[model samples]
Target: MKKLIINADDFGYSAGVNYGIIEAHKEGVLTSTTMMANMPGFEQALNLHEQYPDLGIGIHLALTTGKPVLSNLKTIIDVDGNFRNQAYYKGSFIIDEQEIYDEWKAQIEKILATGIKPTHVDTHHHANLFGDFNAIYLKLADEYHLPVRNNFTNTDSNRRTTDGFIYTMETVIQSSETLEKVFEEYNSVELMCHPAFIDKFLLNHSSYTYPRTEELELLTHPRIKTLFSNHKTIELTTFESI
Candidate 1:
């Protein structure tokens, strides 16, 4: 069977984001989402989770967009103390691997403390796959026994992951014929998405702003829901099942 895990990233980024994700799961093909433990809408996301217990939640380990869950990070943060943006990681910035490990561990523990069993793990801006960060990402997954979203960089036979990972935003807005080709291509795939209602917080913080609303519309569209239900070979699944 061809399995597809449509996972909305940044579940706890803001109220708009939280609501968008919930709507996607409730009315569309979205089967799972990864929550940002340190994001502003974290508490709201937790409360929403209480109402929708079937939506599989995972830790969206972050280091680029928000403040660190653990304080006094020596390398990951900038002079102003907020975590540095994605550009810093792309450049020759030096970071302490141990700090990344400790901070991410705290993020996982924080979500666990809320009594939400995460289905798997992934990173914001794919930061965890950078240099030594991938090792720490895998380390935490092994310790917690959680499957990870495959970036094709951190492959291990023992680690649980979908056979393929698709990050293209264009595919999401394409026709149903295009989407069907995706399911036919991979035995199991993890499609990364960020669907939101486009609030002030999201508008101010994220560079990828308006596209979120576009994604939300496409995700919850009646046509997309029908595609999932009509396709016998395609199975909408969660990371927990992988």
Candidate 2:
């Protein structure tokens, strides 16, 4: 049978986003979410985990766009501690993968130590696919025996662009096909997404935030319900449940 996993990303970016995700779980088809270990409202996510015991939570594995959990070196992060404003940057031929991996492990350890078992793992901004970082993520998933959303999605011709960020965004936009294909190709697969409202605040803070809201709209659409009507989908069996 075809299975579906409706995952919401950015569980701990802000209280507003956290509230939106929880409400989505209650009122929509959100079965899973990824938490940002280094975000401001992460504590709020932890509190929500305590209250909503059935919500399947996993690490978002953030290495871009937010503050870093580690303070050792400014390789993966800027001098201000926030991740470099861009995705996948290299400084003078140095990709900083080692620092990134070290911080990634630390973040994972911190999440596990929270007493909240992670149901699966995925990256915050698709940083897991950068250089050798993908192998590091896969190794961690294998070590924990947890699944991860490998976004091996195909890109349409219209998605091809000279701009890196826009091209990547379009790749993700065209990912439902990739997600479904992978679900059939592998057992117990995972897919990641960001869902939010296109409010003025989100619009002002981030350009991709609106696209994330668009994802939310699609995930909660009635057409998706019909598409999955013939299949049996699970709620991801949260770590909290076990």
Candidate 3:
């Protein structure tokens, strides 16, 4: 009874990404997606959400890109008055976890303001999983009673459905044997995926490129859909139902 939650990250990153995600969901195996609250294409993402009501929407809690939802942050910003990339946070000593909580809560509130309650939560660059901010993530999830995505790998012994995720790009790799191995390895697992059309924003502002298109292709693959549709062994589900 293995369950696969195929979640597309960065839904609100841009219009191209939003279209790609919708395509992945409508024509493929994407069961869930997480959106950036402060991103430019947020409204477009919401429009897609309206068009496809069943696509599970979650918060891609941001601390790495775009402007903060709360104004005038004392810490967690580089000298350029913007949040630093994931690399800086990995070694940061001056950041305030409370600020992270406040900012993240505001991001969630923005989504709620649109009357679109999120189904679950995860973070950009996995900010919550790496440092003191993990406490903030737990606080929000517990307070809201929402599912939080943990970075679980296939090799972990206690790989429950909610434990984390196995990535298609990193693990599946366009290989049928590798795809089969995932079903063999875990009873229930969530797959974290990033699928986009690789717009200028992603090219100029982010380190990630190329693999996004590849992941989208892999997610929409006919074999992958057939595997999930077979239904007896693997079920594709959202975290809310898991």
Say which candidate scores most in TM-score: 1
Counted clashes in each candidate structure: 0, 0, 2
Computed on alpha carbons, the lDDT of every model, listed in order, comes to 0.87, 0.64, 0.79
Q: Runs in model 2 with CA error above 4 Å?
A: 87-93, 152-191, 198-201, 221-242
lDDT winner, 2 or 3: 3
lDDT of 3 by residue, 20-124 (tens): 899889988899999899888899999989999999899999998987888878787777767777788667467777788898999999999998888889899
lDDT of 2 by residue, 158-225 (tens): 32111111112223224456445555554443345667755554555566765676666665666554
**Candidate 2, number of clashes:** 0
With candidate 2 superimposed using the best TM-score fit, by how many Å does residue 78's alpha carbon deviate from the native? 1.6
In candidate 1, the residue pairs with backbone N, CA or C atoms under 3 Å apart (3 or more residues apart, or in different chains) clash, namely none
* Candidate 3 TM-score to native: 0.89
Among all candidates shown, the one with the greatest lDDT: 1
Model 3 RMSD in Å is 3.1
Alpha-carbon shift of residue 52 in model 1 (angstroms): 0.8
